[model samples]
Target chain A: MFRTILLLILLVALSYGFWLSPDFKEISAGVAIFLFGMFSLEEGFKSFSGGTLERVLQKSTDKTYKSIGFGILSTTIMQSSSLVSVLTISFLGAGLIGLGQGIGIIFGANIGTTTGAWLVAGLGLKVNIASYAMPMLVFGVILIFQKQKSIKGIGYILAGLGFLFLGIAYMKSGFEAFKASIDLASFAVVGLKGLFIFTGIGIFATVVMQSSHATLVLIITALSSGQISYENALALAIGANIGTTIAAIIGAMGSNIVGKQLAGAHLIFNGITGLIAISSISYLMMGVDYISIYLGIADDDYSLKLALFHTIFNLIGVIVMIPFISKMVVFLEYILKDKVTSNRGFDSAKYLNDSVLELSSTAISSILKETKHLYDNVFEIIAHGINTKRQNIISDKSIDETIKDKYSKEKVDIDEFYNHKIKGIYGEIIEFSTKAQSTTISNEDIERLYSLKLACRGMVEAVKDTKHLQKNLIKYSNSTNRHIQKEYNLIRQGIAELLRSIYIISRTKEEDVVLLLLSKSKVNMEKYDILSNGTLDRLIRADSISDEMATSLMNDSSYAYDISKNLISTAEVIFGDVENLGMAMSKEDIDLILDKKDN
Target chain B: MGIKKFIKRAKEILGLEDEKKESKKKSLKRLLKKLIKRKREICTMLKDKKSKELQEELDIVSLQIKKGKKILHELYKSN
Candidate 1:
């Protein structure tokens, strides 16, 4: 029904223009060139600022207001909201930013994108911008050929300018052609029919181009050429706002739960705003006229009015919705409910959604979430390793029997299938963290990333140590020597204490609790030393302990001490500062015991 | 002599009429004794042993021992 109405208006307008204006062909050609130039400019800016922009977006802080500010600033700088939305989806998928933060950034992004509309409107009203556009294109082409990095950057900026002008030129030319046609002119002047027709035109154009800035330029050109009135242009601007939200929704479809919620919020924000603007058409037209008269661009040029209406609609939307942001968030959550069977594995690349990278705020927050998941997974694995006792560390005989008797051989292919399944998840997290860090993140974000990376490394090291301890325990169990058994038991207790301390420190977030645990770990280390030294002295006096057993016992004691020391240091790094490392080591001072042995 | 003869005749009647049954049963019992001798050996190498030409032979022996144990337990229950 909407399409049928829109087509009738275009047909009437085309017929009227055919009988009216002269030099319409020249004008159409100019508008085409202008539009081409604008597209080139937008593309060039994207190429020049892609990686650094993505990095900053991935490291967004938790503050909601800060994310909103970042969204606006970044979109304004990049001149595209689609990019911002895609980046948001990526971050949400990676679990870097919460749904609320993503929504705020998207909202800010919408406002930032209007800067382009205003720029186009201002340029359209003035003396020919095409005159400047040609030179930019020429210089841009030359710079594109240059090999130097700085030259390339300049080339990109020039190309962008050239494209911007070209887009404007094309828009101007198209409107002129339409204006000259008598049929088009008469159709455009058909009052209420014309208003709905142009509004539909604006929505279709913006949706097709995936850019509100481009659509606004076309509307300004049509109005300036006298093909449409100020009132119809305002209606079109309203429709354009609704069309812009489509890009965000498309970007969120491939993302996870949080991303879908953000996309839903974007739609609601734009939809409500569009509804209000459309319903108050007369008021909007009055405001646009007032701005046009004040700006002295009211004469045939409707560009000023277009720019004013765009700004007014956006500003009103922000003001009306700002207080109800929490409600909007809840509504979005209700719409995009969490999937029941979603995979929980960490994926860093998902945070780098190609679309959201254009919008830096959402991208940064997504990256932060991915890093947190990586840290948590590594911590969980380490805790599991520490808790697994020696008896259970050996492959359980009952499980093996069950596998052999009941399950198929294919199901028990341990090396080919089981190991890969477990390690693949870890590999993905590491890969993502590496990629995220490679981007130009802020110092604070870098600190957080570094902390997570280090925590993962510490956990991995702890697991390796535990495996080594398990191997030694198996060896001792096999050897029937009573002395070896006794030594193994003693070392096992010390190692168990060390593992407990590491697990406690890793799980804790509170500084005071971590400090208390570190002190207790130090006390355990002191007891370990006293027991080890006493056992060594007795062996030396009796000459009963074998050289191999003594060596093994010594290695075990040293490992215990090293592990304890590493755990304490890890805790200190996490909690920040510790008083002393050797506070309670006087009981079996290893150096004094060694000196007595030498004597 | 009388009880032993009766048991041997019963074993022959229940599909153990082959000449290798007595030697297979003896070797199977020895393997079981070795396995139960220590926990470490049972944990590490119960399913990890290997042989080149005699690998199939070892498998057959192991299976035979498992079957013999099951049959002996059934016989004891009946008695």
Candidate 2:
């Protein structure tokens, strides 16, 4: 009820300013200052709230409506929808939140964003808010320089004041420019063409500024400047609401199904509301005008009407859409059907939001997720390499054709990209994770990140070994020497066993399952050792195997053992105590042990 | 004088002395011994891989061997 009355008051003030205000620039400036203040206040509040906001987000795992409510409350406090959306994506990627839950959160984010718009609209009517901005700025600077945590609150207060005035100043300038135009009133009609034009203007403006709040401030400025009527301003406000969905859409494009779905729900909510608002523009204008007259505000006061329209439209949209969330989800699923199966490949960019970096714990979690994806990619490449080798041995024509025609090129591309491109990305994540670790991250998060980094490094080393083995196998296959072929086959068998152990360890989450696989890998190492010793003994006896063949076999054996050891060590890091795992040994040790055995 | 110099060069290239032969054999044995030590190293590495230790270690013998192989290839190419 209070919200409705507040909406009505803002609408009347807006209408009066548009119709009767002699100083259009001042009115617009006032609105801008209010918006800037609201934005700064929200940012200040977010820093003050810190982990509490994240904790609130973590508790939002209930149904969609609850999640949306949580999203609204959190984003409202944080004051940035971009931060909210990026955080939501990170959470979704981490499997902390479901698709439906994320959708609700995003929906809530849209609503939360309107708090800034409303604050601007309400405060735009005031004549003397700018007087307070300077003192706030001064106090904020003092707080910033105080070097004490308690004093930072003063800085936030000052920043909020400064931003409010700055916002007002720009808004005033825009309105003055608009009002000074000779034919401003000629553009005030609120028909279908007007609606489309205003909507397009809103979306384009929001996209340009990358902030819906900025676009809303501009709309208010134009309304208060007498450049647009209340009806046209309302149309533009509705458009701004829809335009805000663009950020989430761009965010979802490169992300997974859950991200796309969450983004889709945001679009569906806004798109539907946009359609409804456009259709009911005449009625909504009548409603705005009727309320304005009741409050004794003239039709020319466009700023107040625009703010009221913005708030009422979103509130009504939420009320209407809240009941049909499941339907909306289904609709969004249909609309973004292409995202369901198309493997656009994983994007870790969602975790790269600068806002999240300010919060160390969330940033650490994001880094860990990216590192996990990197490890998965490495495992995929190695598995595919093994598959290629197996297909070669069986001489499967279809397999050979697939490898040569399709996967061979892909393998090279992946190798080049992984080795050259992703190494830096992974390294940056590690570096960031390390820095973030010094901040306020939990012990468990730190351990997870550390373990994940080890796993990624191991996988990278394993891929390098696989690449070398691939080159050696190619050479051995082409040589056509029977003795070399036998040695190659033996070495390949050992490598196959090693890969199998890695595959098993990766697939199972149970510690015992990994431990069992590690034991098997150990047994395989012993077999490899016996094979190495036999080959060396044959070489010493001057058997049929050439010296080159003996050397190649030894190299291959050593390589396979090293790769297997790296993989098993990675699994142990994930499952066992990090301290119990002995330090890594060198390749020369394998040869030395074999020589000692021979003696 | 030219013939003597040529003969000396040939002897050096061929490693003709008994002492040189013994030393070559000893070096070969040492290389083989180092290569054989890889068995234990392989086992240890496999253990670490299974356990998944995260620390970065430099100057590792296997890594050195891998490095040595690259240097040897470069020398072979230049020759």
Candidate 3:
């Protein structure tokens, strides 16, 4: 609400300024165009952010210095610290990179942002970049309308650079024209009072713009045109540094706990940096002056001096934070404690958070873990649903004897168990899978996600089939007729054995043996199904069982077969290795292979 | 009377009226027939594939099939 009110007020103020003076209008327009260019550039870069970026990010952030260098290099090339910050939060949330490494990248990003100030002050103010911008825009728009992603990405990059140049030209002229009408330099206070006031203005400008690089470029342009004093520019630079954390904070809002903690680190680092710069303002200005003299910069060249001052202060922040990184991480971990709720006998999703969606592998892994969780719960329910204890079924105890002994026990409400164990988690896995589909992921990962979803569906169907068979199972299990009672026991024993075999296969480490066992299990089910049909039909034909009993037995036998088949298929998805899963092997593929062998 | 007539007309247009019930039942019957046919084909294919794959384990399966055929013959004679 406060942000909305601030935005409304800013809009009204800008409108009033535009009406009063054309110069203010041009400056505001320049800022808008530059911010738009930033957004376009971020979009363009995202096109090439496939597995390569994630691989590079994972491999590069192993050590502190390498992570910092990565932050500096990427931020310099991308020219958007906000993008780097968001990626850091995402990586941290996905557990791909540690918290301390994330902090290091953010630190390097702050120092790297000074490159924008240097570019604007040194080249943009010197050359008529608008001339270059015109041709780039024409070609960029042409490429933007092309079909390919890479082409469109290039188009956005060209157009973004063009807009950036054009915006800089507008701001330079706007400040130049404003010098004739009004003297903002007259408003600049002297001493520490001027430092505090200008710093406040700098922070407000950056918070409103959401980009400190934009704020810095604006400060440099205004300072170059003599609209703002050199001392005031330095102070505004400090404010801009501190205010950029708002973007990181906003980006982390929808992310997981680690993201929020990293955002906290960003604020703390920037605040401390700003305080140090402000307290020793004179000393930093002296250092900047000394550097300016050494580099042969003119005393009146406040724009270059301001850029130097920006770099020095950010460097100071990084240097100060270096000694206490481990301490900082511990403090952040202490402050942002993970929320622990009662287990309640149902497993909540461990890795399926919004943050994991940023990376495809992370998203895929999270889905796999959550599916395994659902399978575990389903394991217990399916065992108990068949009127056999899971321990007895999986143990060396004969499944036939176990069912024969315990068939008279009270039946488990398969429907109730489905609701309690499978329904909520199944919904979450599907929801998470559907949500992950929208993210930029690899084709292989998408296939994995879809396959996992189907596995969950198969498990649910198996449970529903069990529920259907439960009614007749209870009725015939205690029947006075010997033939019908034995046949029902066969149905229960068949399903229990299949479940037990699958449970064992899922835990085994030997892939080849697991595959062979799974195939044999498939054959075993077929054999049992054939036997059940024959035995039930023969009992009815002998006039040993009634027609109703025979019909129910036939239907229950089919249900048992289906339940076992679906459970085995689900196990293959959960337990099979990527190489042997043969998810890529379709009927058409098998036929083609067989044709080749035949040839 | 006017509102009732309008609602009835709307239901007819939307295919929610009872007059559309016969066609709905026919379509449902057609779907069930298609499903049942598919199920039988799948069962036949499954039986053949498993018999072939379970070569060493086919002894028990053959006995089961032989028994089922004998009972099926008895059922047909009784009918």
How many clashes in each candidate? 60, 49, 0
Output the worst ten-in-a-row residue range by lDDT, candidate 1 chain A.
Answer: A402-411
lDDT of 2: 0.61
After aligning candidate 3 to the native by TM-score, how far in Å is the CA of A288 from where it should be?
Answer: 4.0
Give me the TM-scores of chain B across the candidates.
0.37, 0.36, 0.41
DockQ of each: 0.00, 0.01, 0.01
TM-score of 1: 0.60
Alpha-carbon lDDT, every model? 0.57, 0.61, 0.77
lDDT of 1 by residue, A1-599 (tens): 87588678866765665445444544544544545554555555544333455455656636766677778887787676766666666566555567777877887887887777777777545668778878987888887676543345557668777767766776676666655544344545345676677667777767766677667777777777777666777777877878777755655666666667877788889998887787777787787677777877655556666777787888788778877878887787776676554445322233433333333333344444443344344333332333323332223343223222312211122222213333544455466556666664444446655655564455445445544544455466345877776666555445545445545566665433344455445545554563454876687468766777677666656654655555554445443322221112233433333343346
Best-to-worst DockQ order: 3, 2, 1
Error of 3 at B22 (Å): 58
Tens digits of per-residue lDDT, candidate 3, A8-58, equal: 998899999999999999998998988888887887776556445677788
Docking class of 2: incorrect
Cα error, candidate 2, residue B60 (Å): 26
